[model samples]
Target: MEPGSFWTALIWAIVPMLLLLAAIWWVDRYEKEPLRLLGLALVFGGVLAPAITYALDRAFDIATSLSSQQIVPEPSLGVGTPLVEEVVRGLAILAVFLLVRFEIDDLLDGLVYGGIVGLGFGAAANFVGIWNTPSLGSDTDSSLYTSLISQLNHVFYGAVIGLALAAVRRREFPILLGAIWWVDRYEKEPLRLLGLALLFGGLLAPAIAYALDRAFDIATSLSSQQIVPEPSLGIGTPLVEEVVRGLAILAVFLLVRFEIDDLLDGLVYGGIVGLGFGAAANFVGIWNTPSL
Candidate 1:
């Protein structure tokens, strides 16, 4: 692609992602979180986090006899990658949680923070993906499709992560403590159950995405062979994924009646999960790009 064309396509690809981020921010209208933290999270997601993962992968390669091909082919959307990436991404939220436990106050606050972190992670990852990919000699459609899919997938994944983390924190610690406190004092039987449910759902999201991708691939192959109708996102696959995620959120909400006052906690927790999911996805997306 010409330099001019590449610039145009890049701009187009970015605008919608920004709009989506704005929409998410608008939806979370309670506390307007500082853009500085959000920016930091994005930096962490796009650069520091991916760098750390890359370093770890390299270390694994050096410590063992694993070939690049063997390591590179590790499932991108599976239990293994998500497990590792989620922990790394969660660190961003954990950092904030530690410092601001006094301000968190409610479940929804958790969701908001989680979403912010996830949005930052997703944006950084998407930016990297777009920046690294060649313009494909001016075929903007491919780039646009890639951007759209990347954005939506990251957003969804982040949301789920936010919800899961929120649920867990709600159960584990309902009140803030000073440095000397060794344990949480809240008895949260309900939130504990909700946390378990969130864990189960968060674990399942990637599995479902993988299954749907595979199913779509198979259906497309069959369609090409004239054996079935064309397979697309509209074939009930995306809906199924959404339903599963919704059920997970509902399970947590139903189980935990922590009090309306604690809504911020939920938001913050959900946001953290989203941040982790988005950061993980972003890391993989950048790492797997044609160029490092």
Candidate 2:
């Protein structure tokens, strides 16, 4: 370990873990859980459970080595390591279950918590693995990639264990599974309409706004440089931009009226319009920006 490697390693390790946890938290969006409890679970799985697993694994490894004639033992992927790590993580979940039985209201809840706990463990393990890698250089890139893959593996295995432990109501499984299937089964919007909406919003809207800005430049004391007494680009900008955007939506509505069945349908169309406009505008802005 280098002198200041501790802080560097801690930062790299904790950041990715935090991001992964955030994603898991979002997945449990329908029924948000207590952040404090989840944080604690993270700590238990990352810190406490890993420590317990390490001790048990080392002890078992030593015992097995003494009994068996295996000359070199592979600690990293040894059967003992997975068995011990999972059991320890499962115990952490069990402790939470005993104290907060109500929190596990359904199988979904169990799956989320299980995945979270696993993520915590993965975070710590990833930190250690990455922290120990060769100093930041080309070689470390592969190490970082492997670290992410392993962490995800841990979360997946943890979720599987969680599902196993949860007492699921069989009747609800079909409904829950059907909802996912339904979302996938929905019809997709045409790409041609999407492209047209984007072009209108991005190119046509900007061009119209520029023209209007120049045309409305009323100057009391006109000079070549100060011909257009600096207009409030803010107020008129949004109004012009929105109207142009609305025109795009109106075109879609007229052409594809059948698509707008309800509020959700309208929102879907509106979202497409907004997304296309924003994407094109941003792309152009980035392309035209002086910094670039």
Candidate 3:
């Protein structure tokens, strides 16, 4: 193959693999692993490990070719190259486990990380497979099919490593469960109440701010015209804005007094209200700002 063709085939083969890897990443939606560790795992498993495995596979193939003694039957995939490849991949996973034990939180985390490592391996392997297949007289469709199958195979093998890690963790499951239960029993709050508080606070904050601003302007106008000889406008705007933003929390308190069970709950509700008001004010400011 020409250099351009080789590069194009490699890109085509690797694109789907990357998309699948991204999907695997979303499986651990919350509390993602550190980027550096994940990157390291991909590089080590995908590049370094494959290079080592390739060298070992070549040595095995050379020894088999040179042997004079006749074996009853040639080694099948179940006991031959497939098995060796799995072990080589497993070694990569084992190294990650030993180096970064803290990151392996649960079964799902193991599955995600293991799948990533496998994805790297599959991508490296597919690059070579896609590049070499045309020389072996395989069609483009056949090369694509092989690439897809190889990616799936590697991801599945990587998931097996996750299963093993899960099993290891499960041995102390009872102790872990008991601790979790105790903590949850003490700190549990209804999801519905929290959602309601945040929703009410966010939606009501802007309206409350608007009403207070109108009322303050009217008062200021009245005071300037008749009630006060001098217009005390210096502190009026800041005072009105701060109090108006704060009224959202008061509204929440009136709406769901029972939900605010503790000081921490109050702080959370107040923070949400402030966040909403600030967001609204920011949007208005940006929308009014002149574009360059």
Q: What value does the lDDT take at residue 145 in candidate 1?
A: 40
State the RMSD for candidate 3.
Answer: 23.5
Q: Model 2 residue 54 lDDT?
A: 55
TM-score for each of the candidates = 0.49, 0.49, 0.50
Assess the local accuracy of residue 117 in candidate 1 as a C-alpha lDDT between 0 and 100: 58
Residue 84 displacement in candidate 1 (angstroms): 3.6
Q: Could you give candidate 2's per-residue lDDT for residues 48-80 as a string of tens digits? A: 887776566466662221121112344444666
- lDDT, candidate 1, 184-239, per-residue tens: 22433344543554464555543454465456552211122122322342334334
**Any residue pairs clashing in model 2, and if so which?**
none
Score each candidate by Cα lDDT: 0.48, 0.58, 0.59
191-236: candidate 3 lDDT, tens digit per residue = 5655665665555655655565456552221122122221323345
Would you give me the overall lDDT of model 3? 0.59
lDDT of 3 at 162: 56
Report each candidate's C-alpha RMSD, comma-separated, in the order given.
Answer: 10.2, 17.7, 23.5
- Show model 2 residue runs off by greater than 4 Å: 1-4, 60-78, 133-141, 168-292
Off by over 4 Å in 1: 1-13, 54-79, 134-138, 141-143, 168-292
- lDDT assessment of candidate 1: 0.48
Highest-TM-score candidate = 3
